[model samples]
Target: MAASDVTVGVIFLAQIFVGSLGNSSLLLHFLVLDFTGGRVRHTDLILKHLTVANLLTLLCRGVPQTVAALGMKVFLSDLECKLLFYVHRVGRSVSIGSTCLLSSFQAITISPGDSRWAALKEKALRYMCSSTRLNWILYGLLNVMFPVVMTGNWSHRNITCLKDFGYCSAARHDTTTDSLFAALLSFPDAVCVGLMLWSSSSMVYILHRHKQRMQHVHKVRSPKSSPEPPKPSSSW
Candidate 1:
């Protein structure tokens, strides 16, 4: 292998090592909390989901790339390629959707007591699981057709084995299928982005108002700190 390829391999390995360790540690911590404390916070639950997603992503992408970088020629059959690609895509979608859910949940949790969202606060945990289930279902359906587009044929002259698995192509050049796939992938991500931004802004506004209220209370309760009139020097 060339020096550049060795360097790339090292980097990929480092990424996999650090990422896997971090996600594992986080998931372990959350599991401990759940077992010892006998309850899991909404935030903790969301974090657990995110950690799982990250681990999946790291495994799906990093392992293959790292192995390839090491100059080991690995070939995947069509079935393996399709399954791997599907898992990677689903993991990415779940990560994004989970993040959006976390943000929106926090926003609702912190909303004014009189607001309509406050009523749903008690049910948020239940909703979290439901939303996650829905996330899986939605992404699973969205990518159901993914395997049809991917191929592991190595005979095609246009297909080159430059990267890790050269035999597997993610999609063919069919315009209609490509367009539909693009739309399916982009739609959920767009929704996630929109929800994140909206919830983030609401949380910011709530925090700002809370800070102002605290400052006002502090000012009212604080005793006067005016300096005493300067006394004549004792050594005069």
Candidate 2:
């Protein structure tokens, strides 16, 4: 193997090791809390789910890339490549959905009582669970297209041939259709990121206002300790 290939392999392996360790630690912590009857918060639930999704992502994307980087010949079959890509895509989608859910949940929970979304705050915990399940299902179904559109090119095992025009059997795949689908699949990620930004911003504003209000109250209730202006000493 070339020196460059060996270097790539080492990097991939390192990524796998570090990513696995962190995700495993997070999962372990969540499990410990669950078993000990600790009050698992709503965010905790989302985090636990995220950890699992991240681990799957790392495994699917990292391990395969690592093997390939190591210059392993004929290590994976066509079916295996399809499966790996599918799982990686699904895991990534789930992570995005979970993050969006987490942000919205926090926003709703911290919203002012009189806000329009206040009603959602009461059901936040229940919603968190249901939303996560829905996200998984939705993304899973959507990504089923991955495997369907994808085929392994055994002759050039390094590349995948994605079905586009429905007629061409050659190694070259349709780039336009592939790009379109990719953009479509990325919609959820974009939406989730926007939601997170909005929610976090609103939360920050609310807290800042609350802090100001508290400060005002403290000033009103507490007597001013500063010495009065010398009682206009000389004017008298």
Candidate 3:
């Protein structure tokens, strides 16, 4: 194998190792907390989902890429390819959605009582579980086309409309169909990312305002310095 191939394999291995380790640690921590009867917060639940998603994504994408980079010609069967791609897509979507949910929840949590999001603060915790479940279901249903479209690399013979995916290939649709599919797959992700950006910005603004208010309160409550009386005697 070329040096470049070796380097790519090494990089993939490192990413898989680090990502798996970190996500596993987080998963274990949450599991321990649950088993020990520790108080589980809404964020903790979201974090657990995020970690699991991360682990799934890492294993599915990273392992396959690593194998390919290592010059391994082992091609996945059609079913295997479909399952792997489907799961990977689901995991990726869930991960992004969970992150957005967490951000929005936190933003609501820190909003002022008079803010528009104040009402949501109370409901956020209650809905987190359902929201996560719905997120999974939505993505799972959205990526259902993978199984139908994906095939093993060995099956790519005489196929003019095939999109190669290293270990597997997918049947290519016409331009209009492809565009529609792309839009469907991207719409949810775009919304999640937009929400994340909004939440992050709101949090930063809220924190800044809070800090300014604190400074103002401190200034108001702080004792004024007494006049320096001793210096007058020296002047005399």
Tens-digit per-residue lDDT, 4-52, candidate 1: 9899889999999999999999999998887788676668878888899
- By lDDT, who's the top model here? 3
Task: Identify the superior model by TM-score, candidate 1 or candidate 3.
Answer: 3
lDDT at residue 166 of model 2 (Cα atoms): 20
> Candidate 3 on 74-149: residue-level lDDT in tens?
5687778889988999999999999999999899999999988888877887888899899899999998998888
The collision pairs in model 2 are none
Cα error, candidate 1, residue 224 (Å): 3.1
Write down the RMSD of all candidates, one decimal each.
Answer: 3.7, 5.2, 2.1
Quote each prediction's TM-score: 0.85, 0.83, 0.95
In what order do the candidates fall by TM-score, top score first? 3, 1, 2
Location of the lowest summed lDDT over 10 successive residues in candidate 2: 162-171
C-alpha lDDT of residue 17 in model 1: 97
